[model samples]
Structures are given as structure tokens and as C-alpha cells.
Target: MSQVLIESLSATIVDLPTIRPHKLAMHTMQQQTLVIIRVRCSDGVEGIGEATTIGGLAYGNESPESIKTNLDAHFAPLLVGQDAANINAAMLRLDKVIKGNTFAKSGVESALLDAQGKRLGLPVSELLGGRVRDSLEVAWTLASGDTARDIAEAEQMLDIRRHRIFKLKIGANPVDHDLKHVIAIKKALGERASVRVDVNQYWDESQALRACQVLGDNGIDLIEQPISRINRAGQVRLNQRSPAPIMADESIESVEDAFSLAAEGAASIFALKIAKNGGPRAVLRTAQIAEAAGIALYGGTMLEGAIGTLASAHAFITLKQLTWATELFGPLLLTEEIVTEPLLYRDFALHVPRTPGLGLSLDEERLARFARH
Candidate 1:
């Protein structure tokens, strides 16, 4: 048997329309752009993956254009001649040279894992290890920015049995105004749904100090990234003092950040994101750290499309426990899908497919239509 070498690597930028304008603290998302990654192997197998972000450079360092550019110029050259089956070696090679392109690396790593899984006739979950669960309970984000509208959306989702956990995007408006909005939605939904808030690092420590107390008292389930990621001491203080548990999102840019945050007791829950940690395997490293340190885990998303969502799902299914569940409702937020079949969401959970690789195939015509020329 001969070693199967990677023949080529390519990335395409696809712009997909969203169901609505997704309002975050930093920016409003009119649409989502995905950097679709494809890795061609000598054995004639091609694997697909996605690297997506929210609001261009608004969310993180890697924008869609930058991700595509780096994948083409830097990642492709290093991976083209490597052993396609040796994902560990391939990832290590990227790590040795790359500094902080976790978003780009995640897509490449997913493609490699997808390729390996396809070659071996196994699902990516089985390739990671064995899955403990075949489905994950997904949380929906209500970011319509209107209290009544957001409540209506939640009711519809609940009516359809699609979602019962709603996370509100706050911190964009005045603290009191945002508080009123969140509390109003919570009041309307009242015990029927688990309401949470992601401040998106908008609140300062002082504002969060009071806001966290109010949210916790009002029956909010969780508070995420209330203050800035740069204020380590403040995060530690808030974590220790807040009535509700604080979840680290932006603070964890890598696995090392997870370890450091754990050691410092900066947060009680960690938001596990594959793009932030480098890849599916790398994100698991962060999950292990959280598990070892007794910190809870919530599977987070960068609002990725189908390929990225399923890739994240495959990694998440292998976990022993996900204390805060997941927010893998990215696909549902999009008005269009580039995949042949959309992912199944039923009874408030996203079902993980047992099929090979990520259990998805690109709809080529759709992809071509959405791809940026």
C-alpha cells in the first residue's frame, strides 16, 4: 500500500443570506460569509470544510477574505505534499509555522479529518473517538433586537418544538435598556424557556457588576463574556461574585487560554469553539481542560454554515458531558444552504448523522452560485 498524498488545497468564499439581521454588540450581521475549504487527495477523494465568521473583522482577527487568502497562499503550500491520512502530522506542520490563524487552521483540519473519515468509512465522531451521544440539544440566539419580536420568535420556535433555550445578544444598547429588553423577554417566556445573555464584552466591570446581579436575580440562566477579555482580574472577580455563572467566550482564543483561565478561576463555564482553538481535535483539548478543572462546557459557534456546524457537532458528540448544551443553530439562521441536504433539527436537538465523514456533500450548483468570483 502506498501513502496517499494531498494533491491540492483550495478555498472559496461564499456569501449566504441570513433569515434576519443578527445584531451583536460589536456589529450587525446582514449576511454570513463562509470560506469553504476543499482538499484533494491522490486517491481521488476530496473533503470539504468551512471557516466562517460573523460581521467580517468585527468578530475576530480572521475575516472571510483573510481566511481564504491564507488557505490559498500559506496553508495549501504546506499541505499539498503531506500524507492525507496523517492528520496529526499535517496539523503539527501547520502549528509549527502558523501563529494565530486558528480560524483558517480549523477549516483545514476539518477537511483532513473529513478526508480520513471518508477513506476509513467512519464518521468524524468515530474518528475522533467514539460518540457518547448521537444528538446535541441546541440553544437558539434571539438577536432581533426587539423585545416583542424576539419573544415572538422564541414562541414560534417553542411551538415548533425546535428550541426551548434562548440566548439574547445584549450590551449593544444602554445597560438599563438592554436589561429591560432581556428581562422583558425572560418575563414573557417565564420558565417556559431557559433565558441567557451574551454581553459580547460590551459591559465594563462596573456595569457588569450591577447587571450580573440583576440578571441572576431575574432568573436568567447564564451570563456570557460580560466584560472585556483583556481584563483577567475583572473576569476573576466577576466569576467569584456574580450570582449566575460566567462563561468565557472571547477570552479563550486558544487551548492555552483555556488552561490559564481555568487556573485563574476567571470563569465557571467555558464556551468551546473549534475556530478559536484551531480545529476539532484542538477544541477537544480545551474541553478536556475544562473537564479536568471541573469547569462546565457550552459548545459555542461562530455562526458557521452547514459544513462548519457539522464538523463542530462531530467533535461535540464525543464529549462525556456538555453542561450548557450547544448553540449549533447556525444553519437555521441562514435563509439558504449550500449543502445537498440540510441538517436535521428536531425536538430541540440537532441530530448527528452516523454516515461517513461529516455526512454532507456540497450542492455544486448552489456553491457556484454563491461563490465570490
Candidate 2:
């Protein structure tokens, strides 16, 4: 008789146009495509997860198609016979047996946890060492490009009671010019809020210094990825001199990167994304590194739908020290949701779902409507 054999793993690309346009230095969009991966055990237990492919391939070096194909053609084969519950063993095997594609690896990892949790009738957060916060404080994004338009967007979010923290996108314009725009938005919001900025690899060290000085004076809470991600010299330079605590976004992708960043005193904050860091356990390890170093851990998003959003939410819930506000407002950015019960947000807070597994239920109807092909 055949043993528990490797079965099938599959992916779907769901194109969800944002209900409102979300702007970043790389691109502006009213829509996003999520690479949703589903893996099954031979006995029919299944799990679902998401990988976000940003910027249509040109901007972020990834796409939904690439993430899905990597999972189906490369990663899934390695997991076919492996025990689904042994995530540590699975990850070790993944490193030895497969190559590096962190985003793709993360997508499959999420699915595995989803399957494992469902089998035990537990939420993924429980498996991650239980939860600390059932709800997360969310930040609203100030649209990029136009300063006045961004402030208007911020005001709109405030009117709707949708957010308490505001993240401004800075990078398309020169550093000084960008600060002018940033100042305009921050001033518009007045004394009632906190502001942060994501440079998105748009500035150099000198510019980072000047801009951070101005934003810091204007009450900016932090400066995210002030300089280019790949510039170690710049990371060190900015981390040492910048007035605002520097946060790593485009940089710090792996445990090695996390160790390097902390060892070199590259930044005061670590921004962890499940998609970029690869999976929950991987990000958690990174979190432990940050905590040991007395650094702040901030959860980031990739503008994902419910699947990826909830996956990150589960991880964030279990984290012992997520000291900074989170940007897990992907569902809010989308025009619609594909979850049966949406992650509830009130007073700028998002409640972690209490359901079992990754704690999300997909709406098949929405999937049918959004699938590009």
C-alpha cells in the first residue's frame, strides 16, 4: 500500500482593483493582483495563503505569475511527502532542498500553517505561541505624488474615523521638495495625529538627513527606508545621524539581513512583511532578533487581500513586542473584500480574527469575479 503520498498544490491570481487609488513612488493603482496559493494533504486537508506581487514586475522584481509558478513548479514538490505539522523540519528541508525565493516560500509556508491549524481546530496565532493583542492599531496612507491631494485624502480618512496613524509616501520628488509636500500634509492634519514617511528608496544620505530633520521637527514619528535599501554605507550613515529613528522597509529581507542590520546599527526599527521575509516563523525569528537588540518591530503590508492580511495579522497578534503601529490596512485599500467575515476595524484598530487556522474564510464569489485568467 502506498504511504501518505505527495498530492497537489495550486495557485490563483486574483486581480482586485482598489476601491480608492493607492499611490507609491513605484506606481499608482486602483487595482492589485494577489497570488493565492492553496496546498492540500493527501487526506484532503487544505490551507490557503497569499503572496503579493507589487508594481507589475518592473517596480518590485516580482509578479503574481512568478510567485505562483515558483510555488507550483518548484517549492510544492519538496513538501509532498513531508509531515505538514513539522514546520521547523519543513523549513530546514526547504533551505537544503530548494533555492531561495522568499516571497514564494512565504506563500507556501502560510498555506502549511493554515492546513496545520485547521487540522487541530486552532488559530494560527495559537500555534505561534498565543496572542498578546486581539486588535491592531492601523495607519492610513497619505497618497503619494501630490501633496495637497495627499492631505485631502488624510482628511477624508479622518472624517470616516478610519485611522489614527498616517503614513506619507515621499520619494518621487527631490528630498527638499518631498519634505515640502510632507510638511503640507502634516500641517493639514494639525495636532491630532502621528505621521510617518516611507522614502521607498528615493533619497541619498545627505538628503535623508535634511528631510528627516524637517519631518522630525514637524512631528514625524519615524523615517522608513530613508535611503536606498541596498546601500549599507547609507544605512549606517543615516542610522547614526538621522534625527528620527530610521526604519528598514525595502531592506532587511531575511534573518541574515536582520542580523546584519542590527549588528551594524543600521536602523532603530525593523519593518517585517510576511511576504518579503517569507513566512510567520521567519518573521518571528527576525522579531526576536529585533527584541534582543532593543529595536522596535513594525509590521508592514504588501496591499494584500484578506488571506495575506489575516496571515500577517495572526503573526502580529502573537508577537511579544510589536511596539510600532502597523500598516496592515490592505483590505481597506482594496475596493472590496473576499472574506466571509472581514477583520473588523474601529477607532483606527483592526481586530485579529478569532476563527481557526489562518482565521479567514474566502468568499468564492469574489474569487470568481476577480480572477484575471
Candidate 3:
């Protein structure tokens, strides 16, 4: 007998002050909240998961408030008595009743797997089918703003040996103006680093082609989401014209989107974020499809903290064909860490925790310190 039983679950909204404001092409500033979920099994084992959103949830269609509400009002009730080790059964019920709030669902999923890992005396990665690799390469982000500032930030990241690859944010609505800014940053970086640009669905096909020509001349690696996420026509046109390989972020929200993008050759590489594609299983399936088609897959981020980041790290290590670099460096930006087992970075790679389960422990005290109403 498992001798394990689920107990009451709790969620909190926490405000993590950024060590420094992180700007993107879309916007800037902070005040975002993370939806943190804690689950306990009567065997003295517990697990933690987080549901995070940027710009206070409006950007994603669900905020931490609604996340907590869904966890309390629906998900928790269905799991209070189920076996902690029966993860699949629990997921069946959770998915059957809750179709939306995929972010919230991801948080609860982490808690369930966490509980399972604790009960089985294993790490969450083991429950996910064991690890294929022990570490992942990391890519640093260049926040949108002045060309000088962006170039300076890139230089600093390189000097620290923290990031070997960089994703620079562009898109000020004018193609030539943004290209000029990118050119200046590239000029400063020289030939010592690799650079990629994320337009965040801000360019039209014609403008994207023009920008690609300018960036390609400077040895840029790839262009990400240059056109609207929903604009299939624009995607096709950009794919046909782009001199650099194209990658997709916002255009991919589900496995269906993944298949569609791959079929149309809209993306040469796919950015897989667990939160963006519904859950872990969805991400794996997408990666399998992508790799099958000879497209490289890169791990992505949703600006997640320790809990979500660990989940992503685990999935990334499991994916067999993760050739592209990952950007799971959200913790490095925060003023403090919420995990007990610190995630370490060395020589531009993130070390995967070898211990059983997700290989992370929540700092309950720190969680309280940053709780926001």
C-alpha cells in the first residue's frame, strides 16, 4: 500500500523585486506577482510549484489571483484525497475539470510531481522518466532600450562568462531604426559572441526581410517571431525571404501550433517553454515532432522563478535533441532566491541537480518575505 494521502493545498501571490529592471521590446518595469502552490502528503512529504505571469497576468489571460483561485476553488478539491504517487490519475481529474489557466495547471502539476518524488525518494526528474543530460547551456538576454546600454549589458554578461549566447530584443516599429540600433550593439560585441534577435511579433514580412538583410551581414544567428504570431501568411513570406534562420515564440502556444509552424517551414528552430505549450508532456511531444522534422529545439522561459525554472530545466535535460541554447536565467535577475538547493552556473552552463525529485527545495521564509498582499 502507498500509505500516502493528499492534504490541504495553499497558494500565495508574492512580489519579487527585481535587482534591476528588465526591459524587453514589449515593455519595461516590474511589480509582477508569482502564484506559488504548496502541496503536502500525510507522510511528512511536501512539494512546491509556481505559476508566474508577466505584466500582472493581463498579458497571459490569467493572473496570480485567478491562478490561486483556480487552485483553491477547483484543482485542490479534486486532489485532496488521491494517492500522491498516482500522478496520472490526479492529472486526469485536474485536466478534465480545468481546461484554462494552463499556467495554474503547471503549478499544480509541479506540486503533484514534487509530492511523488518525495514519496518515492526520488527527484522530480526521475518521475518524468529520468535524465538524459546533466546540464544545459544558457543564453543571456539583452533588454530593449538604448543601443549603448544593450551593448554594455552584453559585454558585462560575456565578461562574467555567464552567457555564451545572447538574445537581443529589437522592434521599435520602424525597420531601419531598429536595424541601426542592432547594428550598433553588434558592432560593440565584435566577433567574440553569438547574437540572435527577438522581434516579439512586431514586424511585417517586407520589413522583416530588410532587417534580416542588415543583421545577416553582421553574422546574426537567427531572427525570432518577426511577424505576428497569428499571421500565417506573414510567416510564410518571412520564411521565404529571411537570410537568417527563423524561430517562433508567441506563434506557438500548443502542439497544434508547433505542427503548423514546422509544416509551413515558418521556423527553423522551435523555442519550447513548458508554460507556453500547456505542460511538460506537451513540450516533449512538440520537441519530438520538431526534431523528427530536422528542426532544432531550444528551451525557453516565461520569466519563471526557481520552481518553474527547475521544471523547465528537468524537461530540457530529458529532451534528447536540445541542440539550441536555453534562456532560463530569471533567477539571476531577482534580488534573492526562493530555492534551498541553489542552482549553479559555471562556464556558461547550468548544472542539473542530481538528487531525487525536481532537485529543488523552496525557501518558505523567503516566499513569505516577498508575498504581495
Candidate 4:
């Protein structure tokens, strides 16, 4: 075994246009900003990672700007001379100084894993306890907020055998309006697709109370984060009352949050996101907690590009069960790809890379084309 010393670490902000505006409860995203992390080792091997957020600050505390600043000003300095092969040690060094840059940490951790996997001649998934499955069923988000357009899009995906699980971004419209849209789409798709909704914590308890039952009655598979994440009492009430399974997304940020939700019986399902739970392995810890508490698993996305998406896929493939599938169609939403070989999506599932590392290599030309600088 050779000790690979970290020689350099850099973060770049890349702005890529989306195929269309992605509407959410808080903000509409017309483009995706990625905080791309590149780590080079003494052995001359380089690994790539990404920290991506939707609608920038509208979505979460970590923005592309903040991720880049934190990584360059603080985290990257800590990692410069460390042993890249000792990923835990490298991560711990950052944890001691940093508090809540989970997105940045995720990016760094991903790059570390990619480097280690390449060095070991294995895929990143193998390094993460080996993959239990090679391919993951991916879900597409219908965020156009147009009933007819969403229906048509879902039909097209189903017809093409691309995505059978559809997640509608609701709660932006009025309760009645959102319900009508959801129901209409569900009715149109019929049993051809599984329809779910992510409220993104837009509704109050009262609104969720009514909407949950209505959606449940209409055959919606799940309702995600109907109420705010802090409203644990509301979550508990909704979990007990709603016929549709309540999934906690904004609620479960860390392992501690997962335990709290599980202990309070706040939710029936948890949306496992790599950036939210710190990194790939950290999210796995959150998943383990959810699994022990009997909460169903959902592989959520931050609408990541290739680096972050594959980092997530690597971790998700190791999970024993993903009941609600995944929304890892992040890269597909972008107009351009930064990876040389884009992730393979077919038959309604995203296939894991068999190549060493994250099974990805950056397209420098595309990176230069989209680079914010």
C-alpha cells in the first residue's frame, strides 16, 4: 500500500442552465450552480466531487458560493497535507474545525472516496461496503406546475421506458389547486406510473391535514415534508392521521435528527440525501438509523451534477432497501454534462458505474465551457 499525500484541493463554481425552470415550493430554479471540488494527490491521481443546491439559498443554508468559500478558505487548507488514503482521518480533520458545511464536506469526502477507489482498482460503491445492487430505480420530478404539460411529460417518460416513478413538486400552488393538479396527473397516468409529491415543507399543519387525506384517497404513494421540519408535533400528528405515508426530508438532516424523528414517530419514510447528512458514509449512518426504526427509505437528490450524483449513487447502491426509489435524475435536467461518459439511464433506472472510482471522469472542455470564471 502506498501513502498518497494530498497535494492540492480546489473548488470551482460552475453555472449550468437547466432544460427548463424547475419550480419548487420556495423558489423556481432556471439553472443549477455546482461547487465543483477537485483534489489531487502526490501520486498524480485526481478525484472530483460536487456540492449542488437547488435555487441556491432558497433551498438550503449551503449555496454554491458558500461551499466554494468554505472549502477554499477553511476545509481545503486542512486537507492539503493530510493522507488522502485515510479518508476518516482526513474527514475528521475538517469536522473538528467546521460546523455545518455538510455540502462542502460531502464534496471533499466524495473526492477522497474517488481517489481511494481509483487507487484500489474498485468502484466507490465497493469501497462503501460493496454495492447490494448495481442499478437504482430513478424518479423524475414534474415541476412545471402545469397539469397538462406534466401529464404529457409523464406519459412521454413512461412511453420511452425512462422513468415510471414520478415525483410532483407541489405546495407552491394553493391547496385545492395543488390537489387538482396532482389528482389529474395521477388519474391521467393511472397505474402506468407511481405518483408522489414533495411539499418541501410549504404547508402548515392544517393544510397538510386536508391535503394528505385527499392525496391518499387519490392513490398518491407519499407526501414529503408536508409541514416544517421543526414541527415534530405536526409531523407526528400527520403520521398518525394521514393515509398516505409521510416522508421526512427537511426534518432528517443528521443522524441525531433521524433518531429524534424515529423516537417521536414523526414520519413513516425518510429522504436520504448525501449532502444533508454530511457525506456518503454519513448519510448511510442516517439510513441505518432509519432502517432500525422501521422507517422506509427514499433516495433523495439535491439535483446534483455527475460528481455529486454518482457519489450519491455509490452510497445508495449499498443500501439494503430503497422503498420509494430515488430522484437521481439531476444530471439529466442539465443542458450540458461535465462527465466524459454521462451516467447511464434506461429502463427507468440509473445504472451504477463498474469502472474504478466514482466510475466518472470530468470533461475538461465542458468544465471550461460552463465555468463561472
Measured by TM-score, the strongest candidate is 1
| lDDT tens digits, residue span 215-247, model 1 | 999999999999999999999999999999999
| Residues 123-190 of candidate 2: C-alpha lDDT, one tens digit per residue | 99998889988988888788746777777778877888888689887787666787878777777777
For candidate 4, the per-residue lDDT at 224 reads 93
Model 4 spans with C-alpha error above 4 angstroms? none
lDDT of 3 by residue, 265-321 (tens): 887889998777666655777898898888898898877887788888888888786
lDDT of each: 0.95, 0.81, 0.79, 0.91
| Best model per lDDT | 1
Error of 4 at 250 (Å): 0.9
Which has the higher TM-score value, candidate number 1 or candidate number 3? 1
Worst lDDT window (10 residues) for model 1?
47-56
- Residue-level lDDT tens digits of model 4 in 37-73: 9999999899888888877788778889888888889
TM-score of each: 0.99, 0.95, 0.94, 0.99
In model 4, the clashing pairs are none
Backbone clashes counted, model 2? 4
Q: Higher lDDT: candidate 1 or 3?
A: 1
Candidate 2: residue 74 lDDT (0-100): 73
Q: Is candidate 1 or candidate 2 better by lDDT?
A: 1
